[model samples]
Every structure is written in C-alpha cells, then in structure tokens.
Target: MPLTFHWFLPTNGDSRDVVGGGHGSPATVSGRDRPPTVAYLSQIARAAEDLGFVGALTPTGAWCEDAWLTTAMVSQNTQRLKFLVAFRPGFVSPTLAAQMASTFQRQSGGRLLLNVVTGGESQEQRAYGDFLDKDDRYRRTGEFLQVVRGLWEGQTVDLVGEHLQIEGAKLARVPDPVPEVYFGGSSPIAGKIAARHADVYLTWGEPPAAVAEKIARIRGLAEKDGRSVRFGIRLHVITRDTSEQAWAEARRLLDGFDPETVRAVQAGLARSESEGQRRMLALHGGGSDALEIHPNLWAGIGLVRGGAGTALVGSHEEVAERIADYHRLGIDEFVLSGYPHLEEAYWFGEGVLPRLRTQGLWQHPFDTRTPPSAQVPFAGAATAR
Candidate 1:
C-alpha cells in the first residue's frame, strides 16, 4: 500500500515553542499565541488538504477542544481531508458513539476516521466519572469496539460484557464505507485489544527495531484470530533544506524548554499509568542530553511532552529516508506534527513529500494531476506594481 501521511490540528493551541501537555501533564497555555478557533484550525486543515495529506488528526482531552465538535466544524472547511478524531471510549456509550460517527460520515461526505483512546490515567478518567483501572479500561475498549462495529454493520448487537452491555442496538442508517478504527497502546492487554479490533495499530515514535517488534507481535496475534492490521506511528518533525538548518531548528525548540518546566512535566508524567508513556520516559530518562536516540531521530520533544515524545529531525532527504526506514518496518501510515503546525505543514509538504513521491513510496491521496510549473525565479521576474 502507498504510505499515507496525516497532519495534526493543535486543538489545545499553537505556539512557536513546544506546547507541553498531553496524557497526564498540564496543558501549556502560556505561550500559545494561536487559540484553536475554527478559523485558525480551518487554515491548517486547508493547508494539509492542499498539501496532499489524506487526513488531519484532532486530539481529545480536558486540556484540548473536544475532538468531535472541533473536527465536525473543521471538516466543513476542507472538501477532501478526513478527520482522525480521537475520543475516549469510557466517556461515551458505544451506541451513541456509533451513531455520532454515522452522522459525521454522512455530513462530511465520508471523511471520518476514528482513533479510539482507552483512558490511561486514573485521575483524568475519574474526573470524567469513569473509575475503571487501566486494565479494565482496555477491556471496556474491546467491548466498545465490538458494539460499535456491529452497529456500523447494520446488525442488532446484544452483548453482555463486563464493561459494556448492549441490547438490540442497531443503527437506523449504517455508515456507507464504515470509518476505520485506529488504536494504540503499549501494554500486553493493549496489544491484544488492538490485534482483535483495530484496523490500524498506532504507536508513539519508537526506534525501528522496537516498532518492528510491535508489528510482529500484533501481526502474530491478529493472524491467530484470522485478522490483519495496518501500522502507524506518531511523531513531531523538523525537516529543512539542509541538515545543519534542521538540527539548528531542533536546537531552537530544545533551547526554548525551560528547565523547571521539564522537571515539573517529568515529575507529573512519572506518575502516569500508561506503558507507552513509560517507554517514552525511558528514552530520555528526564534529561536533555543525548536526545538523538537514533539516526535523525530526536527525543528532545519528549522532554516535556507526555504522549509522543520523539521526532524525526533532519533535512528533507534525511527525514524521508527515516520515514522509508519505518516503512520498511511495516508502517503504512504516519501521524506527524510540529511546534507551529501551519508553516511546518508547508515545509514537510513541499520539501519531503516530493522526495517520497520520487522514491515511489507515496502518492497524493486525493490529487493525481501533474504539479504546476515551478514559479519563475523572483530575481528574474518583473516586479509587481
């Protein structure tokens, strides 16, 4: 399959500096210059669409705008971009969630993709009135997907599970081209749930060997159950015209991280119940040193970030090479973001995507027309009046 790339909508806010806060950490609102208004988010959405991204992911959390509502509004601004809306399963009933997805698909012209988040933090989950422990939440997620899938298939689902109960549940009108479910977790239970239920198993950016291990494990489990799953990775990026410039840009973001904020965020994230978060913490060990965990792979972003803490930092060719490396390891999709999403979208879209196209690893998800001729050299062109 041709590689699919997706951009992020920074629903909490956008900033030049690293916007810390995800999972269990506090959302950094201080340096956020661009509030996540419909206009601003629509700008990013349109850019991603025009740049040939297949979709844009909108995150869900107490710190961020509601993913469903935000994406529903942003979807109207783009004709071709799908919205990978993230939502916690424990927060909403499966039947209602299915119905909402059905409506979103119809309204958005079948541009809906679901990212199922099984709540990982106890305190955050309780704040929303969910008391299930980490393991139970994964169990509940399994039941939730079962019910949701059945309804989307136009079946009368009746399942009496430990976590969820559904009786005679059916959608009035099934979603035409049912939305794909994207799920991720690092625990054993998470792998099991994903193998049995997920269409694409997502992972925070890890080294190629680690990612390959995950893919193998999930494939084994899925094969046992007569199923197969695609793979995706989430990461921040810093691609530039030259290697020196990209590394310098990465250094700038690293330099912006306040020592105290990193300490505090690390302390808060230390108490997280997520296995994935644990692995991310181990990658840097709460220190700023040796952030280049792998070739062109930087862990500096994970210093204050809770979830995806790594990034691919290098020139367009190097970044494209790193993506190709992961692709060889079985990653069919990439969910990527940067400090300031708008300009970064253009950087990666124009720079790296073209290289990938030349390598025959990617093609525009929506457009196939030959690109327009290169703009005439500014120095040679007549000045506009």
Candidate 2:
C-alpha cells in the first residue's frame, strides 16, 4: 500500500522557531506571531490538500483552539482534505461525541478522522474540571470507545462498563462511513486498549530500534485480540536541497530557542503523567547538545516541546531515506509538521515526495489522474518567481 501522509494545524499559532505548548507546557508567546485565524489556517489546509496529504491533524487541549470547531470551519475551505480531529474522550459524553461525528461526516462528506487523546496530565485535566486519575482516565477511554463503536455500528448500545453507562443509546442516523480512530499512548494499559480498539496506532518519532520494538509489541497484542492495526509516526521535518542547508535550518531554529524557555518547558513537562512524554524526554534528556539521536533524527524539538519532539533533518533525499527506513519497520502513515508549516509543506511535498514516488512508496491521494511529475501544484512556484 502507498504510505499515507498527514500534516498538522498549528491551532495555537505558528512561527519559524520551535513552538511550545503541548501536553503540560505553556504556550510560547514568541511563537504566537501569526495568530491562528481562519484565513491563515485555511491557507495551510488548502496547501496540504493540493500537496496530496491524506489529512491534517488539528490538536485539542487548553493551549489551542477547539479541534471540532476549527476543523468544521476549515472543512468548508478545502475539498478532499480529511481532518484528524484530536479530542479528549472524557470531556464529552460518548453518545454525544458519536452524534457529532456523524454530523461532521455527513456535513463534510466523511472527511473526519478522530484522534482519541486520554488526557495525560493530572493538573491539566483538573483545569477542565476532570478529577479522574490517570489509570481511571485510561479505563474511561476504553469504555468510551466501546460505547461509541457500538453506536456507530448502528446498534442500540447498552454498555454498563465501569467508567461509562449508556442505556439503549443509539444514533438517529449513523455515520455512513465511520471515522477511523487514531490513538496513541505508551503505557501497558494504553497498548491493550489500542490493540483492541484503534484502527491506527500512532507513536512519536523514536529511534528505529525503539519504534520497531513498539510495532512488534503492538502487533502481538492486537493479534491476541484478533485485530490488525496500521501504524503511524508523528514527527517534524526540516528537509532542504542539501544536507548543509537542512542542518543550517535546524541550527537556526535551535538558536532561536531561549535557554530559559527550554529549561522552563522541560521542567513543566517533567511533571507530565504521560508515558509517551516520558519517552520523549528520555530521547533528548532536556539537553541541547548532541541532539541527533539517530541518523537524520534530531531531538532538538523536544527541548521545548511536550510531545513528538524529534524531527527528520537532512537533505530531501536523506529525509526520504529515513522515511523509507521507518516504513521498513511497519510504519505506513506519517503525521508531520515543521517550524513554519506552509513553506515546509512545499519543501517536503515538492522535493521529498517526488523521491518517495520514485521509490514506489507513495502516490498522491487525490490526484491519481495526474502523473507524478505534475502532482505537486506548486512544484516550480518558488523558482518561477
């Protein structure tokens, strides 16, 4: 199968520097130079769509705009671009969420994908009036998926699980094509729930060995449940015409990081209850030096970011090679973003995506009619100027 690619929506904001504010970290004021207005986000959405990304992931949390609302508005601006709406399951009832998904699918012509985020920080959850502990939150997510899945299958669900109870709950009009659930977590409980429920199991950008181990573990668990799930990795990218240019961009972003801000963000993330965040911290160790954890993988993003901190930094060919390596380890999807999303989308889309096509690993999702050479809409736009 052709590898699937997805981009991100900087709902909080966008900047040329590393934007903070994920998991438990506070939003970086300097990174908020370009506000996440509907116009700006629409430009990104249209660009990703024209560049052949399967979808765009819009995050949910206290730090960013609401996923559901932002995607709904953006959906009107683009055709054929799916929205991977990241949402916490506990804040809203499962039945209501199911109904909303149905409405979104119907209204947007089934351009909805759900990213189920079980809140990882205790204090952050409390800020939203949720008092459940981490373990309970995971349990609630499992139960919530059960009810939501049942209702989506057009069944009257009466699940009386430990965390959720639904009595004769049913959707008035079930979604024609149910949105695939994309889930990520690093704990044992999280692995079990993902194996049983998620259609796509997402992981942060880890080293090849670590990522392979995770794929093996998840595949085994899912097999036990008589299910198979696709795997995806989330990372930032810094591809350029040459290796030197790429590293220069990485250094520029690294240089832009304030020493105190990195320290403060790392300190804040230290209190995160997320196992995934813990693994991210392990990769970089909150140090700015020697950030290349693996070939072409730079961990500088984790210095101030809370989740998915590593980036693929190299020339376009090198970046494509790294992606191919991940694909060999069972990653069939990639959800990626960069310092400035609009221009970076073109960098990877025009430069690296063509190389991937040459290797027979990818094809434009919506432009099968066009040849590979004509796939990227702005292939020569930069030079044409």
Candidate 3:
C-alpha cells in the first residue's frame, strides 16, 4: 500500500510554544494565542487539504472541543480533507455512535475516519461518568466496536458482551464506504482488539527497533485471526533547512517550557493507567537532558505534553529518511503535528513531503496536481518570534 500522511488540528488551541494537554494532563492556558474557533480550525483544515494531506485529526477530551460536533462544522469549510475524529467509545452508546458515523459519512462526502480512544485515565473517565477500571475499559471498547462494526455492515446486531449489551442495533442507512478504524494501545488487550477490528493500528513515536517489535507482535496476533492490520505512528515534528536549524527550533520550544508546568504535568501523567503513557515517560524519565533518545528523535516534547511526546527533529531530508525507516518496518501512515500547527504543517508539507515524493514513498491521495516545490518559501516568519 502507498504511504499516507495526516495532520493534527489542535482543537484545544494553538500556539508558537508547545500547547500542553493530553492523556490526563490539564491544557496549559498561558500561551494559547489562537483559540479553536471554527474560522481558525477551518483555516488549518483548508490548508491541510490543499497541501496534500489526506485527513486532519481532531482530538477528543474534556480539555478540547467535542470532536464530532467540531468536525461536523469544520467539514463544511473544506472540500476534500477527511476528519479523523478521535472519540471515546464509552462516552456514547454504540448504536447512536454508529448512526452518527453513518450520517457524517453521507454528509461529508465520505470523508470520515474514526480514531477509537479508550479512555486511559480513571479520574477523567469518572468525570464523564465512566467508572470502568483500566482493563475493563479496553474490554468495553472491544464490545463497542463489535456493535458499531456490525451496524456499519448493515446487519442488525444483537450481542450480550461482558461490557456492552445491544439488541437490534442497525443503521437506517449504512455508510456507503465504512469508515476505517484507527486504534492504539500498548497493552496485550489492546493488541487483541486491534487484531480483530482495527484497519490501522497506531503507535506513538518510539525508536525504530521498538516500533518494529510492536509491528511484529501485532502482525502475529492479527494473522492468528486470519486478518492483517496496517500500522501508523504519531509524533510531533521540527523540520528545517538544516539539522542545526531544526535543533534550534526544538531548543526554542524546550526553553519555553515552564519548569513548574512540566513538574505538574509529569505528576499527573505518572498516575495515568495507560501502558503507552508509561513507555513515553521512560523515554525521557521526566527530565530534560538526553532528550534525543534516537538520532533526530527528540523526547523534549514529553516534558510537558502528556501524549505522543517524542518528535522527529532534523532537516527535511533527515526527517524524510526517518519516515522511510519506519515505513520499511511496516508503518504505512504517519499522524504528525508541530508546536504551532498551522505554520508547521507548511514546514513539513512543503519541506519534507516533496522529498518523500521524489523517493517514490508517497503520492497525494486526492488529485494529480503536484504539491508546491520543496524550495517554495514559507511566509510565516511570525512563527519564529
């Protein structure tokens, strides 16, 4: 399969500095210069569409805008960009979720992708009235997908699973093309669920060896079930004309991290029930030193951010090489973002993507028109200030 790329919509907000929040940490509010209004988000959406991104991911959380509602509104502003809406299965009924996806698929011209996030923090889940323990949440997620998938297949589902019980669940009109399911988790249960249902299994930015191990494990499990699952990795990015410039940008973001905020966010994440969060913490160990855990891969982002902590930081060619390294290990998709999403999208879209294109590793999914040349100058000098 051809490689695919997607960008993130910082629905909580955007900033030149890193905007902290995810996994269970509170969003840092001091530097959020751009609020997530429809107008601003639509600007990012339209930019991602024109730059050749297949989709944009809107995150789901109490800290961020509601993914379904926000994407539904933002979808109206862009013609071809699919919204990879992140949603928790436990917050809503499976039947209603299925119906809403069917509606979104029809209304958005078949531009919908689902990122199934099994809520990982107990305190946050309790706030939303979901009381299941960590492992049981994964179980509930499996059951939820079962019903949702059956309904999307135009079947009237009747299942009495351990966590969810549904009867006669069917969509009035099934989605013309069923939305692809994107899922991620680091635990054994998560692997099983991905094997059974996920069209694409996602992992956070780990080193090449770690990611390869995960791909092998998931492939083994999926093969046992007579299935195959594609792979994707999520990460922040800082690509520039030279390695030194990229590292300088990384240092700038790191310098902006308030020590107190890092301590508080790290403390909150320490209590998280997510195995994935555990691995991320191990990469930097809640300290700021030795953050370049791998060549051109920086862990400084994890100091304050709660999830997807590591970043690919290098010149455009080096970043493109890192992406190819992952692709050789079975990752077909990359979900990427940078500190200030709008400007960074242009950085990677114009800088790194064309490099990948020339290497025959990627092609635009929407049209035959070529993307802007890698040499095209970006006008967002304000981001540097």
Candidate 4:
C-alpha cells in the first residue's frame, strides 16, 4: 500500500510563534492571531483535504477545544478528509463512545478515525476529577478499549470489569466500516494494550534508531498477540522552496520564543509522565542550544509545545527524503503540522507531496475533492505593478 500522511489541527490555537499547552502544562497566553475557531479550523481542514492528506489529527485535553465538536463541524466543510479524533477513554463511557463513533462514521461517510490517548499526568487527570495514577490510567484504557471494540463488532458486550461495567451494551448501528484505531504510548502497559487493539500504532518523532527500536518492540508484542499493525510518526513539518528559506523560517520561530517562556514550558514538560514526552525532552535536553535531534529534525518546538514537539525541518526535497527514510524503517504513516498552519500546508502540499508522487510513494488519497489541476495561489505568483 502507498504510504499515508496526516496533518494536525491546532485545536488549542495557532500563531507564528509556537503555542504552548499540554502534558500538565498551563496554557500560555500569547498573541494568538489565529484562534482555534470553527471557521479557521475549517480552512485548515479544507486545505489539508486539497493537499491530499489522508486525515487530520485533532487533539483531546483540557487545554484545547473539544475534539468531537470541532471535527463534527469541520467534517461538513470537508468531503473525504477523515477526522482522527483523540479522546481519553476513562472520561467517557465505552458504550456512548462507540455509539458516537458509529453516528460520526455514518454521518461523515465513514471518515472517522480514533486516537486513544491514555492520560499521563495525575494533576491533569484530577483537573477533570480523575484521580487514577499513571499505571491505573493505562489499566482503565485497556478495559475501555475492550468494551468499545466489542460493541463496535456488533457483539453484545457484558463486562463487569474493575474500571468499566456495561450490561448488554451494543451499537444499534455498527459503523458500516469501523474506524481504524490509531494509538500511541511509550509505557510498557500502553504498548501491551496498543498491540492488542490498535490498527496503526503511533509514536512521537524520535531519532531513526530509537524509532526502529519502538517499531521492533511493538512488532514483538503484536506478534505474541497474533496481530500485525502499521506504524506512524507524529511530528510537525517546516518545508520551504529552498534550504535557506526553510532554515530561516525555523530560526524565526526559534527567535520568537523568549528565554522565560522556553524555560517555563520546559520545566513543566519535564514533569510529564508520558514516556514519549520524556524522550522529547531528552532530544533537546531542555537547553536553549543544539536543536537538530536528527538529520532535518528540529526539537525546538518542545521548548514550548507539548505532545509531538519535534518537527521535520529542511527544504522540501530533504523533508521528503527524511520521510522516505522513515518509511524504509517501518513507518508507513506520518502525521504532521507546523507553526502557522495554512501557509506551511501549502509549502508541504505543493513542495514535498509532488516529489513523493514522482517516487510512487504517495497519491493524494482524495484527488476528487478539488479541481484536477488546482494550484495554490502563492503570494509571489504575481509581481507588483
């Protein structure tokens, strides 16, 4: 199968500077020129759809808008672009979540994908009235998926588990085509559950060697469970027409950050219980200097943002090469985004995607959504009179 690519919807907010808030960190107030509004998010969804992204990942957490509501409204503006809705399992009942997924699938023409995020921070959990520790939260997620999966398969689920209890719960309309589960976690318990359930296992963008190790470890667990799953990497992307332009953009974003903001965000992120977050911290070492964690990969985003903090930074061709390298190492899917989403979408969509097409690695999954020869209207398309 051709490799798949997904983009992100910055649900918290968007800015020229990196907007920060996640993994137990407080939402830092910046001059967010683009609020995460329905209209702005719809623009991004339509742009990603036109760019040929398979789907767009909307995050779940206290810091951001509700993923379900945002995606449902945006889905109307899009034709075939799927919504990879990320939601914590323990917060919602399994039966309700299953039924909601069925409704979303039926309404959106089966364009619904699920990203199960097991909450990692105890304080963040307690903010929503959840007191479960890190380990217990994973345990609850395992139980949660079991029940949701059973219901989606048209099975009458009767579960009296310690975390969840559902009696004779079944989806009246099972998703005609069930949404693929995309899951990510770095902990041992998280891996066990992902191996048992996820259709596509996701990891944060780490170095090639570390990523290979994660793929192998997940493959081993999946094999023991008689299952096989695809792997995906979630990262941000910064591509430009030339290497100089790309590096300049990266440096601009880096320079926008004040020392105080970087220090505060890094301090908060250091307390994150998510192993992936820890690995991200390791890459940048919470220092103001030395960002390229790997070739064409920049860790400067982690200085403020939570979750997927790294980004692929280089010229369009180099970005495509880095992506191709990851594909060779067992990553068939990539979920990416950038600082100011709209402009960067065009950069990657036009600059990198065409190269991938020539290499036979990608085809816009939804070419029918736009005019066959539609092109982005770059500012430089015309010179001043």
Q: Give the worst 10-residue stretch by lDDT in candidate 3.
A: 369-378
- Candidate 1 error regions (>4 Å): 369-385
Per-residue CA lDDT of candidate 1, range 168-197, in tens? Answer: 998999998799999999999999999999
The CA lDDT at 235 in model 3 is 92
Worst 10 residues of 2 by lDDT: 368-377
- Tens-place lDDT per residue, model 4, 126-235, is 88889999888888888888998888889999988877778989878899799899999999998999999999999999999999999999999999999999999998
State the lDDT of candidate 3 residue by residue for 28-120, as single tens digits: 445678999999999888888878889998888878889999999999877789999999999999999999999999999999999999988
Instruction: Tell me the TM-score of each prediction against the true structure.
Output: 0.95, 0.95, 0.95, 0.95
Q: By how many angstroms RMSD does model 1 differ from the true structure? A: 5.1
Please tell me which predicted candidate would have the highest lDDT against the true structure: 2
Going through the candidates in the order shown, the clash numbers are: 0, 0, 0, 0
Model 3 ranges with Cα > 4 A deviation: 369-385
Clashes of 4: 0
Model 2 TM-score is: 0.95
Give model 1's clash tally: 0
RMSD value for candidate 3: 5.2
Between candidates 2 and 3, name the one with more favorable lDDT.
2
